[model samples]
Target: MPRPLPDDLLKLPHRRDVPFAKLTTLGVGGTCRWLFEPTTEGEVQSFVRACVREGLPYKVLGGGSNLVVLDDIEIPVLRLALPKEVIREGTRLSAPASYGHIRLSQDAAKAGLAGLEFAAGIPGTTGGALRMNAGAYGRELVDVLQTFRFLTPEGELVEKRPEPGEFRYRWSFLTGGHVALGYTVALAEGDAEAIAATVAVNMEKRGTSQPLSKRNAGCIFKNPTGSSAGRLIDQAGLKGFRIGDAEVSPEHANFLVNHGHATAAEFAELMATVREKVRAVHGVELEPEVEIWR
Candidate 1:
């Protein structure tokens, strides 16, 4: 028998049987059995501490832009609902992890800040960006990240700069039980018009090359060494490949898109097929950039 949740956890803002398809950008997945949306940092910390104390495992989710859930999640899932406030102190901007990534980039651009220009097209929340070191056009979250605050595995809070080997390509050490709350970015001053123009250009590029009309969890795989994953997949002639409603995007071969009514099983199968085809032809393994939850 499973242990019951702590009494303190039941009072937080939450929902039951929320559809995963609704939460994630891909718009396909099983239901989230327990979706807790804590509106304050104290509520978030309390939930985590309770889980740790009771030997319960939990997952922290943000915008759900980069996740693929294959089955109904039974474990407790927490999504921060911090107030939507952005503060600019000096050349630094701080926001809760729940802040939208692309919107935050646009906000920074509008404020004449320059460092977040690369994040203009990245989806998900700021917390997801920091966790994955999300990047585009050669710049990443780690580049502008000043410092972040997160709950440790043992439910202790810490604020510190990312040390060497902490943040890597689409990966971070803030896994296991650690949950990021918020972070600050170190940006530079730039002309408002110039910053906005740069963001516009980035957005245009993404729209032209990506399969934006279709539902997807952003890029499906990480780029292999010395080459691009999309280029490799395109080269292998896998574009438009389909498994049920899941297809390797005809626009960008690296992206797996969900046509209407696509199933999680189909998505998984499509991903496996693409990986196999790429490995067979190019002898390169394509690691998934999107996190899979089962």
Candidate 2:
């Protein structure tokens, strides 16, 4: 059994049987045991400290775009949503792990910063992006990351600056029990008109190639070396396949969408099917990009 939660943490506004469907882009999930939305960096650290002190199991949530929480399991959910005071300075931006990446990208663009244009279409937060080294169009977070602040499971705050090559394709060292406080991302200067134009072009391309309006995670699987996951799935004839309300998106075979009211179980099943088919047809294994909670 999990340990009891700290008194201070319990006093916060925590909801029981909280529906995760509304929190996720997929719009499907069961109820969570507890949920807390901390609106400040200090609050995030304190809450994490409390959970650690009490030895309670907790899961950190960000924009909810790349997660699939199982409905049948019961677990505590903590959302570290820092306040809007989190700002992007000249070439550096600091934001809570729970803050949205799209908002950050737009703010940076408006500020005339040029390094994060690749993140304009990502639907997560600074913390999540750092954890996954989220990137697009040949640009990655590691390329712009200056440093990061994280709260250890022991409740201590530490700043980390990884050396070059510490981060690899779609992977980072921040996936452990540490909770991110915020980070300073370096950006270059560019004309606002040029930045806006670039953003527009990227958004248009994403809309044409992805199922942005659908209830789906941006990419279900990571692309393998010199190849794309969507191409592999398409070649395997897995497009338009369905398992319950979950379906392999015909628009992008790598995306699995919730047609109406998909369940986590159904989504998992569909992913397995796609993986099997792709592997059998192409002799390559597909890896999930989205995090699954069971």
1-294 per-residue lDDT for model 1 (tens digits): 545667788888889889999999898889898899999888888899888888889998988989998998888999999998999998899999999998899889888989899998888999888888899888889999999999897888899988899998888898897889899999999999999888889999999999999989988898887899999899889999998888999999978899988899999898888888889999999999789999
Off by over 4 Å in 1: 1-3
RMSD of each: 1.3, 1.9
Error of 2 at 262 (Å): 1.3
Q: Candidate 2, residues 1-294: lDDT per residue as tens digits? A: 655666798767667766788788887788777788777767777777777766666787777888877664455677776765556566787776767788889988898888889999998778888778889999998898888888877778888787876688888766657777778888889888899999999999999999877898779898898999999999999889999899999999988999888888898788889999989999999888888877
lDDT of 2 at 98: 68
Q: How many backbone clashes does candidate 1 have?
A: 0
